[model samples]
Target: MTFAKIELTASDNAEFSNIGDETLDGLFGSNRTMPAQGITEFYGASGSGKTQIVLHLALFFLTHSNNPRVVYVSTESFFPIKRFRELLQQKLTRDYENGSEKSADKSKTVEEYGNRLLLTHEPSVESLMNCLTVRIPKLVSECDGIKCVIVDSIAAVFRCVRKSEIPYDERSRILFKMAAALKRLSVEKGMSVIVTNQVSDIFPNDVFHVNQRLVADKKPALGLSWSHCVTTRILVSKCDPMSIPVTLPGGKQSQLALRRLHVISSPFCPNSSTFFVVDSNGISSVHENPTL
Candidate 1:
């Protein structure tokens, strides 16, 4: 029997799509060539805009790429379809008011844009595993130009499964298998795998204190096993709202609070942070230059 050899080259891979946020793209690299072939983790406290960022990325892939499609697997049973539509409508209205596009054209674009996204609700670990291993692969093969797969809050399902019932070893094995499957899918398909995680509180002793108090230090959940599977990890936290006085459309002065984005870990970029505001049109950077 003759053995077949496989060839590897850069040309065989799909290029990474820009997240449509200038500051975020800049953080990845100077040239912005962060490939979309590995798992990226976004973890933070609730109300920290984790899901908003995921939605923004999904919008970017759908609108910016050539016939691109994205699969969003939401385990929380809360896919904000109405909110997404509002964001899209706001963008279209902004473009029309700016004389960037015609009303007729914008309506057509909105309809097409909505068609590109496929949202799935998986409430359990077993369903999530089926989605990642079976359904997603089948969808990718059948659909053209599928670019990204996002799992909102990967920690939620695991959290629901009681640790005492599953045991640490069993849980670790399951997570390992899931991570390995996701990694393999990303590499083989040349698509980005984005997963959001929840943060847990940790208390560490301070050098100045003889007795350690229970200070809440928030870190990503899922332990070290899940941590090793990701290519990039971004941590976002809400800082004290910055009140900036601005002139409203009616020439009235108003104050707006911009949310800050923190990058906790990235292999291609250094640890840094930036500021942005979440409006009807989704996330927009507050400053011309992001804080390093």
Candidate 2:
């Protein structure tokens, strides 16, 4: 795979690229979740809705636009195809119900929307590098409307290196190279690039904290070097279970679980947090906290 030199105009190099969702955009700060010519990272522990958020964004770009497409690179064991299809179907149904359209041809819509998403699996660091720096650029050149590129949990590939014989510095160097390639792609191709990261526990060495029996702090993987590559850093964590009383169809009451999304660092907005829940219809019920 190879990259083509595409010249970008001033307007194409705007400050920020809007995903066209107000609530999702507002989750970052006051402005867009990411820079127009940079990278945004979503880091969190397992079951923190990292994959869910990225899949939702990919669906949005695929369904909302006429010709734009998204390239999702997965490093995990497998991409969540069932969840993605469910989200896509729900989105189509919801749009049809909300709009004035009388007829709902979901099959055709699903085929079209689903076709726009390109999924690639990169199981190793070397393959991931080749995909990003080579294969992705080539795809962009051939596919004129490629709008976004997503790598769900970038930490997965690197974790293999840690368990292997590769030196630590090699990981950092490769990370910088990947960052440069991603930034260049974002600038030249005029596409939004987002990557998800894993979290690791950071235990305090101080005896006082140990004596106090404090819990370990979870930080994004790949340390400070990798953190510097991203323009925006968003952390999603499972906070205290929020029980929302809901009335069932037969007058029965039930509770729902919600997760917390925190904007750790961003160039546009101050650090603020919001609560959101992922259901069968995808990410919904986002309640912002004014006093962050």
lDDT winner among the candidates? 2
Model 2 misplaced stretches (Cα beyond 4 Å)? 1-8, 11-24, 30-35, 100-108, 205-216, 242-254, 286-292
Q: What is residue 244's positional error in candidate 1, in angstroms?
A: 6.3
Residues 45-75 of candidate 1 have per-residue lDDT tens digits of: 8877888888877776665555667788999
For candidate 1, the 10 contiguous residues with the lowest summed lDDT are 1-10
User: Across residues 161-249, which tens digit of lDDT does each residue of candidate 2 receive?
Assistant: 65456677888888998999898877776777889999876666634224212222577888778978988777877655445553332
lDDT of 2 at 69: 65
Cα lDDT of candidate 1 equals 0.68
- TM-score for each model: 0.80, 0.81
